[model samples]
Target: MQNKKLNIAFFGSSLVSAYWNGAATYYRGIVRALHNRGHQVTFYEPDAYQRQENRDIPDPEYAKVVVYPATQEAVYQMLEDAASADVVVKASGVGVFDELLEAEVLKLQSQNCLVIFWDVDAPATLDRVENDPADPFRAHVPQYDLILTYGGGDPVINAYAKLVAKKCVPIYNALDTATHYPVAPEERFQCDLAFLGNRLPDREARVEQFFLDVATKLPEQQFIIGGSGWGDKPMSANVNYIGHVYTKEHNAFNCTPKAVLNISRESMARYGFSPATRVFEAAGASACIITDYWEGIDFFFEPETEILVAKDGAEVAELLQGLTPERAKAIGEAAYKKVLAQHTYGHRADELEQLLLTTPRTATAAPSSADAFVS
Candidate 1:
């Protein structure tokens, strides 16, 4: 337990909104736990008004929410906040001012504050940085005191280390058992297989391969896709397309499906050990899950017993056809037990606290200018 109450400043996407941003759940779970432990947290976000309006939470009780305009004044205010904080975290995919925030927040490390670049999408960020010589973030990588990632495991850690990152830690996503547990199945999400994810370029092809293709293979089985940007995708007769399932409905959505499908983005799958939030959410609902094969999966859950793995659409179809109700129930139960025991946000909060406590807070050379952040 932390003896002193630390004032943490988090600059990230809308904490109150689940619209478009995938990190809301991650932020909520971890930040809420920290708040529970008697720490003060202030969350800063840009006024992406649409997301704000569609917010699941207008105001988050866990942190002081500040929605600033995308202006130079706002940038300066954010920097001031970062400089004064005990631990300042700039999470990736802020949807606005990401580059500016990353560069400016790194500058706060000189003031003896622990500035961390928390990469929610590590593989995508790594790909852009390593592959693109013009990537802006490459130069800024080594500036932060510590780098924490939601996923990407060793590949991300090793890649960032090569970039001269001071220290890198992979803080994988975990279940918030309190909010995401087995609920009675709902009728709206009832289907043989269900998937919930916003369509992004990196994940679209994999979804087609693992979800749509498999749905086609098993035409007799009812399939449902619940997410945004997927309305444009063509669907088979047996497939139901429920555009976007709100945060409140996730449990019902997870519970309703006989077997939920988890299709990782190409980068995430290649990087491995990157279980999407959907995996844990569905498991919390005790829904049988069938996921595409990815590296280091055994690190999270035992593949055959706790979860099902599919190599291709044919394999997905085979699993769907062969998995008995009893076997599926057993797998779901096993996964739930595993998550409750080892992979909850409470466990992650402890790890995060330990990391912050142990990490050396030595000052690094200051960044040249905001323009230096340019790729």
Candidate 2:
């Protein structure tokens, strides 16, 4: 495969470490991988809060950070910066100025640039578009050259197809091995089972169903929960809640726990193949993972070998009680090996490059005309 060195401009919520959003890690991982492959990347972040609180990761060495204002001037500036880039990616869920950013990115298509609508939350986005046909983004989807999602399998592809996207690809969440690896166990995070995920409305119920229920059932065992929006929840004495853990502390949290729990959001579990970034991160750190049952498990890992699938709180209890330390370590090792082999950002970047190469590119970008080609 011929490697093309493309100038890519990436627009997303916030890269500033202070914001501490999970997408920051996603951007850093993929952007760094693209840079390693010799692509020039420029990242645009318009969220002032993220810029103010940015502490997620250090400024990426491989990419240039362009902090744009959350104003009309910022959109104009973004247009000027993105005009000459071969590819301009607008990632979904950028906290601030995304509506404005999306409008500007759509306008850039007429400049003959390859624009990609990269959705991190495919389920949410699809749901929103389905409920409202007159959404501004709905009309723009067909105009964009490609649609990429962070996770979701067939459901996401089908959703994009409904929007008349010329091509849609699911670039599933992957681990950055360099950032996540086995570490010396820490006493603070020691527990029989642990789960790390930010609290979101769609995921809150699953967290209750999988983690909280499991904690309630296994009152004798120590359980630790990490992530934001979990502070107000009443946790059992056995359940230790650590509000929000930073990325750098991820490995210690993974290594300290005997077994880590993976509770997929309602939509992701239903869709299958929708492994969150935490799955790969835990695997990369060689943490034994017991995940809730979802579709397409075989494609990622073999049940009973590389991973343990749980149906509900009772199943989670069964695993917690039965899984010995040695067996847990072996499972973690197996998962680690599997991830290193097939689920790394490097691998995802390769897949993305292939998709981009195979897709037809056009020099003209008139919105109505572009829609005709995509449809």
TM-scores for candidates 1 onward, in order: 0.94, 0.93
Tens digits of lDDT, candidate 2, 1-375: 256688888888766562446676777778888888898989887746645464666666889988776776666667666777878899998777666667667655644467888998888888888899888888888878889998778878997998899888998888887789999999999999999988888789988888898888888899999987788998889999987888889999998899999988887787778887888889999999999999887788888999999998888888899989999999999999999999899999998877655565656654442332221
Q: List the residue pairs that clash in candidate 1.
A: none
Question: On a 0 to 100 scale, what is the lDDT of residue 145 in model 2?
Answer: 81
Best by TM-score: 1
Q: Least accurate stretch of 10 residues (summed lDDT) in model 1?
A: 366-375
- Candidate 1, 1-375: lDDT as tens digits: 247678899988888888888888888888988888888899998888478777877687889988888776776766775566778899999888788787777666744468899999998898888789888899888778899999888888899999999999988888987678988888878788888899999899888888898888788899999888887789888999988678888988887777899999889999997898878878888878899999988988999899999988889888999987788889999999998998888898898888876677755654544533332
Pairs of colliding residues, candidate 2:
16-54, 17-54, 17-55, 17-56, 18-53, 18-54, 18-55
Candidate 1 RMSD computed on C-alpha atoms after optimal superposition onto the true structure: 2.9
